[model samples]
Target: MIRHIVLFKFKPGISWDDPRALEAEGMAAKVGGEVPDLQEWSTGRNISTRPIAYDFAVIGLLEDEAALDRYLVHPFHQEAIRRWREISEWVIADLEE
Candidate 1:
């Protein structure tokens, strides 16, 4: 399986309570159930108080590269990406497991 992880950093002045942030959070929460290729998925705000920690994260497990590719382009995922882009920048890592 492929383990896909994404970390998001909110832009300057953007907070968790921002409308755009809330929308992105809601969209991300729904992607797992909406996309068939995602075997496992979870997303949430960071609880760490330390500096340098990302504001949000997403972890998804897919059966293979093809499934990972499909999840990356899924409409629900795309919509979440669009919403996130409005409030933050992100980095991702994909690993084989």
Candidate 2:
């Protein structure tokens, strides 16, 4: 399986309560059940207060690279990305498990 991880950092002045952030969170929360290729999906606001910590996280498990590719391009995922882009910047990693 492939472990897909994303860490998002809100832009200056953006907060979790922002409407766009909420919309992005809602869209991402639905991806696990909506995408066939996604074996698992979990996303949420970061709880750590450490300075290095990001604002949010998204973790997904997929069967393989192909499945990971499909999940990345899925319409629901794309929409979530779009919403997130409006409020934050993110970094991602994909690893074999």
- Top TM-score hit: 1
lDDT of 2 at 75: 91
Residue lDDT tens for model 2, 18-48: 8888888888899898889987889888999
Root-mean-square deviation of candidate 1: 0.7
Residue 15 displacement (Å), model 1: 0.3
Instruction: State residue 71's C-alpha deviation in candidate 2, in Å.
Output: 0.9
Give all candidate RMSDs, comma-separated.
Answer: 0.7, 0.9
Q: What is the lDDT of residue 89 in candidate 2?
A: 89
Q: Model 1: how far is 71 from its true place, Å?
A: 0.9
- Clashing residue pair totals per candidate (backbone < 3 A): 0, 0
Q: State the lDDT at 97 in candidate 1.
A: 96
Give per-residue CA lDDT, model 1, range 3-71, as digits (tens): 999999999999977888888898999998999998899999999978899999999999999998888
- lDDT (CA) per prediction: 0.92, 0.89
| Stretches of candidate 1 exceeding 4 Å from the true structure | none
